[model samples]
Target chain A: MILTVTLNAALDITYKVAALTPHTTHRVGEVVERPGGKGINVARVLAALGHECVVTGFAGGATGAVLRGMLAPLAPHDALVEIAGTTRRTIAVTDGTSGDTTQLNEPGPTVLPEEWTAFLSSYDSLLRDADAVALCGSLPPGIHVGAYAELVRRARARQVPVLLDTSGEPLRRGIAARPDLVKPNADELAQLTGSREPLRATRDARRRGAHTVVASLGPDGLLATTPDGTWQAAPPEPVRGNPTGAGDSAVAGLLSGLVAGLSWPERLSRAVALSTATVLATAAGEFDAAAYERLLGRVTVVEHTQAASGK
Target chain B: MILTVTLNAALDITYKVAALTPHTTHRVGEVVERPGGKGINVARVLAALGHECVVTGFAGGATGAVLRGMLAPLAPHDALVEIAGTTRRTIAVTDGTSGDTTQLNEPGPTVLPEEWTAFLSSYDSLLRDADAVALCGSLPPGIHVGAYAELVRRARARQVPVLLDTSGEPLRRGIAARPDLVKPNADELAQLTGSREPLRATRDARRRGAHTVVASLGPDGLLATTPDGTWQAAPPEPVRGNPTGAGDSAVAGLLSGLVAGLSWPERLSRAVALSTATVLATAAGEFDAAAYERLLGRVTVVEHTQAASGK
Candidate 1:
């Protein structure tokens, strides 16, 4: 079973308006709410793909309850630790005409030290039964920057291959704990490596202690590097739709393939295909089986020769 | 007792950000949640001022629960009927540097026919004990435009004064029921009257079955027209701060004075004082007694004789 940890889960709200004008009142034509957070998205896609996954994270207050309620139908077996502070909400207002999105993210609930300790204890017990773990999303207030690093260390101790996907200082700190895989989009890779070139940035990320680095380049597809070799996987083409959780879907695809014991090339192919399918799907991070099947054949994976240092 | 009805009460969420740019993501610095809807806001302020107020509205789902939870501490009494759908949330993103506010209002949850029937029946019962009733804010989905009109008629039958505060077609249709008072901001008054001029538009609004019309002109203060007189009550000077909820606070002041048996000039003075105090307060719609007392003497009430019938 795959274990997913989302420290800062959110009630994601999307509003569709004719146009978004600053300092003006807008009446949204459509509003949709869903459970959200990077790990939650990955767990949802994995569950949809018929994988056994358990999502454990901090949830509190009414918003947290609503988020959990929304997730019940999507992922039947999940554990959300109730905390004191309420979960945050992210508002995504999309312009109906231009298809542009404006996002307003609330700083998530603060997790007390005792709450973190409780989560760690619960997670350790859960990880003992899990084959792999995926630690995703931002650290909520009151959580130390090295919280994900500690989780990665615990997963390693339990012999569980962990996938870490986050950005900024959290990712910087977490990489030192040597997670099995780290997925950073092109922009995050640049921030991590201080380089614009994707190939160089992926290599730099690997050097920072991530065993495998998967760099998602929007439209250009995925660039990955491991000790075995480097590879580039490209979808047939970019589909026009909301790309909100495409990266998280890719994380789900990669983890699902790994748990199924698929080859690296096959894993890359699955990741690219699932991400493309997610973009084509109406909802973010959601991919229909037919769409994924149709896109799988179109995802092309080209392996690259390992560098002299074997990165 | 003052009865306030918010058919579509909301959890008003305010986020303070550095600035607002369309199609971009922003991390909010501060978040505040308050129970809201025009009538709810009015009721809260009235309660704060030691007035006996009852708030009746439809609330459902988790968000509605949060709204009710937050309202418990603010209102003297509340009767939030459980409905079929959740209450909506309105997000106001305020730019700290510019003091500009961008509002994104959700089309509130759909009220089922059964829910509306339940609300109307309960509301009619509540009105029997009410000295004055206020029907406020936008109608939720599945609620007819004539809902407020029906409430107005009910209040009329009981000889209870009713104030209608809303915009668009609801206001247009509700006016036919001949509410005792209609308070519209300049822009809303213009929309209702098809005249940009406040004076002409207010007169037009009064002719449309509203016995009295009160137009709130932000810094210019309040304008009211009655059968006996036309009065303009302007605060001595603009005591600047956040203008959010100033209108609702003004309504609270007006209702408080009416219940206290104050004359029109005294009622207008109290309204102006409370409105100014709200603007001076750090939070919207919250008028502290100290601030209200400080501003009471500064409010300037200018009374005008009734305009010639031809003019």
Candidate 2:
């Protein structure tokens, strides 16, 4: 079973309108609601991939209740902790005319001291039955900065392979705990390493204590530096669609492949394919299955023989 | 006791931001949630006015639960019918920089046939114990176009004075049922009477079947045509703020004043004062008590010397 942790979950709502104009009233033509957070999104994709996954997180208030109800049927196991504060919500107003979207994110609730303690205990207990764990998204208010680092350390202590997907200080502190995998996009990589060059940034990330660092280069695909070797993977063609959850789909692909004992190249191919499929899907946090299957074989993974062959 | 019906109750959510830009992402600084619908807003003000108000309508799903929870301590009584469909939410994005607001209103939930029957039964039962009833807002889908009209007839059959506040076909049909009172703003009045002139339009609306008609004239205050006579009541000066629920506040004042056995001039003074106070309040569906008191004495009410005087 796979384990996923999301400290800050959201009820993702999308409102479709003819157009969005500032200071004007718009009657929404359609409303779409779903549960979202990086880890929750990853778990959704992983479940679609035929993996047994358990989702652990904090959920409270009306928004949280709606999210939990929606997630009940999606995830195999739910280990969400109850909190006193309300969960946040994100509204994506999509204009039907220009196919543009405006995002409004509510600030997450503050986690109480006992709530964080309770979450830590639950996460530790959930890790006992997990094959691999993925820690995803930003930390909600009142949570420690080194929260990911502590989780990564705990997962390692339990001999569980963990993947960390976050940015800024969380990613920096998390990598120092030496997680098995870390996937950071170019902007996050540049923020962490202060290097505009993808290759240099990717290598510098791995040296920061991450066992393996996969830097997502947006349209250019992914550059991965690992103990075995360095590899570059790219989709045959860029898929044009909503890119909101493409990275989470990539994390799902990589995490699922690791649990299935797929090689680094195979994982990279699957990750790139799933990400492109997610981009092709019309709705956010969903992948085009047919596209994923078709692109899986079309994805190209090449080994970089110039990099250090520590293996 | 006052019975107010909001067939399409909503969970009104407001998001505060520094600025609003279309097709751009924003982080909301704060969120404020409340129960809203025309009648619900009226009930809120009536409850604040020390009236025993029983609110009845349809409420369902998670949004309904949240709305009911927020309204439990608000209204004197909760008699909202349960339904299968989820209640809708209205989002108001307030831009702090320009003091502008962008509104996004979700279409109300469709009322099931059985649910409509249930509401009618509950409303009839509640009206038996009521001095007056208010049938408010747009009819949700699946409800007959004459929904308000039917409700008005029922209230009249029980000798319960009913005030209807709606627009378009609903207002046209509801007025023909001879509701005790109908409050239509300038636009609704014009649509119903096909007359641009306020005095002529207000009189025309009364001839169509409403016992009395009160036309809200924006900054021009209110024009009332009733059995006693016609009168114009205006605030001393224009009190500027959000006008979202100003009319609903007027409806509350009118109903409450009628139940308190106030004279026409006194009722008009209270209505105009409450409406002005609602505008003075920073938040919607709220009246400034101090301003209401101050403005109550300052409001001017003069009876029209030449008008329909059958009374």
Candidate 3:
């Protein structure tokens, strides 16, 4: 079973309105809510792919209670820690006419020292049974920046394959623990290595202690610099829709491949195909199964050494 | 004791950010949530003034659960009915720099036929001990348009004074029930009686079956046409801040005075003073006691028939 951790989980709420005007009132046409955070989204995609996944995170107050209840049916196990502060809610107001979205994110519940310790204890027990672990999303307030690094170290000690997906200081610190794989989008890679060139940034990220670096190039696809060698995976065409959970879907693809012992090229193909399919899906973290099946055989994975091999 | 009925209650959420721009992302700096709806706000103000208030409405789902828990400490009694649909959340994004607010309100939970019948049963029992009843806010979906009118009739059968506060067709139909009092803001009154003139609209509303019609004139206070005579109450100055709950505060002031058996001029004075103080207060549904006390003595209630009496 894959274990996923979301430090700052949220009750994601989307409001549909006719139009959004500043300083005016709106009568929202519809409201949709779901459990959201990087790890939760990844777990959802993985579960859809027929993987048994355990989700652990901090959930508190009324919003947390609602999120916990929603997660029960989506994931196999719930290992969320209870805390004092209320879990935050993230809202997206979408304009029905234009499809323009306005987002407002709340800083999540602050973690106390004892709460962090309690979570660490829970993590230690969950990792014993986890075949692989994915640590995702931002570090909540009051959690040390090295929280992910400690998690990576604990997973490594158990000899479990761990994937770190985060940005800024936490990502930088987590990389130092040398996780098996790290997925960073273009901007995050550039911010970490200060190189606008994707190839150079991915290489530099790998040199920082990550065993393998997979850089997501948005609509283009996934680029990986791993022990097997460099490979670039691209879809047949660009897909357009809400790109919110595309990266999480890609991470699920890569993790599933890792556990199944697929070649790096095949894994990159699956990641690119799944990410594109997620963009085409109606909601975030959900991919059309038929679309995924059709696109899987069409994805082109070219090894850097082999001059542009076609599918 | 005043009984306030909020057929559509909500969990009001406020997000404070630097600015709100369409199609962009905002990291909200602060979040504040409270139980809200027209009657809930009025009951909170009444409770603040040391009045025993009972609140009843439809509160269900997760948002409703959160609202119910929050209302426990604010209002003395809770007679809210449980329903299948979740109560809605209203969001106000306040720009910290410009102090401008953009609001998005969700259409509240739809009440089933059985739910409406259940609420009426609860309302009938609560009215037995209520000194007066205030029916407030919009009718949720599936509820009949004449909900307030039905409530007014029931209160009248008990010989209890009822104040109907709503707008559009609901207000029009409710006035025919001859509620003892109806408070309509200038726009609501204009829509009901097709008159922009405050005095004419108030009189027209009273003639349509209401025993008393009080029209809120924004910063100018209230104009009332009642059996005693015509009176206009004006505050010393226009109190300015967030005017979100000013009208609810006025309703609380009026209901408090009616139950205490105050004279018409005194009731008008209290209503004007409390409404102005609410505007000056920092948050919605909260009034400064010191400000209310100081404004009360300065509020001038002029009897129109007395040939324009001045302070």
Interface RMSD (C-alpha) of each candidate? 0.7, 0.5, 0.6
Per-prediction backbone clash count: 0, 0, 0
How close to the true structure is residue B157 of candidate 2, measured as C-alpha lDDT?
A: 92
B153-175 in candidate 3: lDDT tens per residue?
99999988999999999999999
Model 3, A153-221: lDDT tens digits are 999999999999999999999999999999999989999999988888998999999999999999889
Residue-wise lDDT of candidate 1 within A168-263, one digit each (tens)? Answer: 999999999999999999888899999999888998999999999999998888998987788899998767877878899899989999999988
lDDT of each: 0.88, 0.91, 0.91
Report per-candidate DockQ. Answer: 0.88, 0.84, 0.88
Better of 1 and 3 by lDDT: 3
lDDT of 1 by residue, B1-311 (tens): 89998988999989999999999999989999888898899998888888899999899888898888887876558887898688888888899899899999988899999888888888889988999988888899899988888999999999999999999999999988999988899888989999987778888999999998889999988888877678889898767788888999888877888788887788888998998888888777677679889878778888765454334
Instruction: Tell me, by TM-score, which candidate is best.
Output: 3
| lDDT (Cα, 0-100) at B17 in candidate 2 | 97
For model 1, the stretches where C-alpha displacement exceeds 4 angstroms are A306-311, B306-311
Q: What is the TM-score of chain A in candidate 1?
A: 0.97
Query: Candidates' TM-scores?
Result: 0.95, 0.96, 0.97
Model 3 CA deviation exceeding 4 Å by range: A306-311, B306-311
